[model samples]
Target: MTGSITIALDAMGGDDGPRTVIGGAAIALHRRPDMRFVMFGEEAAVRPLLDAHPEVDKASTFHHCDITVRMDDKPSQALRRGRRHSSMWKAIEAVKTGEADVCVSAGNTGALMAMAKVCLHTLADIDRPAIAAIWPTMRGESVVLDVGATIGADSKLLVDFAVMGGAMVRALYGIERPTVGLLNIGVEEVKGLEEVRAAGRMMREHDMKSIDYRGFVEGDDVGRGTVDVVVTEGFSGNIALKMAEGTARQIGEYLRSAMRRTWMSRLGYLLARSAFEHLREKMDPSNSNGGIFLGLNGIVIKSHGGTDADGFASAVELGYDMVRSSLLQKIVNDLNRFHTSDVPAVPAEQ
Candidate 1:
């Protein structure tokens, strides 16, 4: 529609096969008629879906890829052997070859990450690519990094994560100088290990002056949206992210069911329905679709495992935004900003 913004989708990647993936692609195309998608999966699976819908026939095309990547497969296996047979692998390769601007999948995250890293590589100065999870804040949406990218890292890595993540919040959302926070057990400087403390100090006294390092914030500050970028180790960050999602879902469901229990409650629900819908959508991870694996040379986004058609649709939308935003160029530019020669030695905050 808009010339050609071809998205190579791994139809076999997620829990739902071609059906959900194809349906989601349709939804995305409908939302933006200018975009076209290439469904890469078994031809048998993709053909029927196309034959049934004229919109899909005219607007989208399917590229046959026979193999599907399993959730439990190893990363290397996904690249070498998976490529030999898997559609997801081929879909990723499509991006590398300029066949597609972005690739979307609801498959195994580790395998996807592995294949992407091997093929796309990481940006210079970026150690481990961090998974940036965009969350709802009182101030709007904020992004938390290493949501499951790296397990353990050094202080400098954390600092770099902060830089890339701050850039992400600014690029995706419009936070000019996003506030950065270190996720630690305590708020005091002396509370965390030397690595955490050192990173915090560097951020506080940072010379780049581009980042807004807000001393320290504990886990509770996450949902409240106190900071624009919350940086943490991958293990800790991932757990915190999952817990927050689970809590939001449970609370939303509980409230919805409770409101339907009585006639007066139902009436009240109708009166305050907009508020409930707003809160529910805000808390819904599926609405966010997929998250970008930052610091990578090419665009790589991961959709949740049990995501529905709507969820898959969100991933596609994010992929489009990633391309339009020129995130790869942004990451490279941000990293180059604090390079060895020209950077001013930002003083550590006292």
Candidate 2:
């Protein structure tokens, strides 16, 4: 792997625009000195921010583009208007041309994914692209895919997510043959949608070396870290992800309210302030901000548009880690190997 990594930024994509994007770049540069950034946006807005952070400015190259893909813009509208000129489009183009190791954007999800698919294209042997997120679990973290790339994945597509997520975990966690689980309603053999069950049986029946398929996993199993990788179709996976985020917020709110209800409780909170701080750090969404678009020829990370500089930094850091891990080449190699083998399907249930 290369010691130095270059990242392209869609400076105009996020809610707070260039300031948020550049601030995040500065924070990430502090952590990774070997990193470089190429910022695409209006020079008038971006240059001053870059100038404020001279260190980041020194490491960054600016490309002026005033056009931006609106947050409400449809995928088709973005493609038509943002084809070659918009900051988001140009940032993705940098990856397609090998100018950057990865592209980081806090943009509209549909627009970003649509542009990425058009620019980077899907890898060989992969039918549809999957979006993978680093889910914070009880056992540290697990990789979950198809978080909302496409809806209604078939059995083979689910298996594809397994392979892709396994490769991602292996790259990030340095684990060989990371355990894989298909997210289901229950762990029973006969439960869940037909596609999930079929995928589970296929993984169980096949002798795939890339991942250790660990059968079915429930929604609760995700945070419990039942497996290193969780595979589900887009619709369910997206809902699960949002629900988890909402649940985390609810728990935090409850904790704060309880801590302030009485003088005695307030004193107790003061005594346990450090522990609470640690818990907050652990639960911070910013610390785990990037959602990766896997199964593409290049790496594309979508950050939460409303997140602050710290959150955006987390996204940039994710992109850096992926580049350092040789993520693209690893996925390509895994797919090539997977396609070469004859993976037979499981028989129909009586």
Please name the candidate that would achieve the greatest lDDT relative to the true structure: 2
Predicted candidate 2 versus true structure: per-residue lDDT over 11-52, tens digit per residue: 997899889999999999999999999889999999899889
Off by over 4 Å in 2: none
Residues 23-136, model 1: lDDT tens digits = 787788788677777667888887888787668668666677667778778887677677545788777777888888888888899898887787777888877888888787
Best TM-score goes to which candidate? 2
Q: Which stretches of candidate 1 lie over 4 Å from their true place?
A: 1-4, 260-267, 270-275, 341-350
Q: Candidate 1, overall lDDT?
A: 0.79
> Residue 11 CA error for candidate 1 (Å)?
1.5
Q: List the residue pairs that clash in candidate 2.
A: none
lDDT of 2: 0.92
